[model samples]
Target: MTLAALAEQVGVAVVNLSVMKNDRARAVRFSTLTALCDALDCTPGDLFSVVDP
Candidate 1:
């Protein structure tokens, strides 16, 4: 889906979603994450992975 469509479906601003999509976001709210997961028909584990710092 397009970013605009995803943003609409996820109930988040396009700019915010763009930031996340581009890996430039510093953090993500749990509510936003859940909304995204629900909109995409996926799970948290599907969207994220451990990154060594």
Candidate 2:
């Protein structure tokens, strides 16, 4: 799905979603993550990775 469509589904602005998509966001609210997970039919573990830095 397009980012615009996903944004609408997740009740977030396209620009904000774009920021998150581009890894520019320093943080994300749990509500927003839950919304995304619900919309995408996935879990947080599916969306994020803990990399060794």
Candidate 3:
């Protein structure tokens, strides 16, 4: 999915998405996660997955 498009749909700036993509974000709000899920037709699990370190 195009983050720019998703950002547009979710009323968030592309830079914010970029930061999230690069793992530079300190945190993400539940509401933002919900908006992303709703806009992308996906779940939080799809957006992020736990991996063994």
Q: Over the stretch 1-53, how does candidate 3's per-residue lDDT look in tens digits? A: 79889899998999999998897887899989999999989899998866687
Q: What local lDDT does model 1 show for residue 26? A: 91
lDDT by residue (1-53, candidate 1, tens digit) is 99999999888899999898888889999999999999999998998887998
Query: Deviation in angstroms for 2 in model 2?
Result: 0.6
What Cα-based lDDT does every candidate model obtain?
0.92, 0.94, 0.90
TM-score of model number 2: 0.91
- Candidate 2, superposed: residue stretches over 4 Å from native: none
| TM-score for each model | 0.88, 0.91, 0.81
* Candidate 2 lDDT score relative to the true structure: 0.94
lDDT of 2 by residue, 1-53 (tens): 99999999999999999898887888999999999999999999998888887
Best-first order by TM-score: 2, 1, 3
User: Could you tally the backbone clashes for each prediction?
Assistant: 0, 0, 0
What clash pairs does model 3 have?
A: none
**Each model's RMSD to truth, in Å?**
0.9, 0.8, 1.5
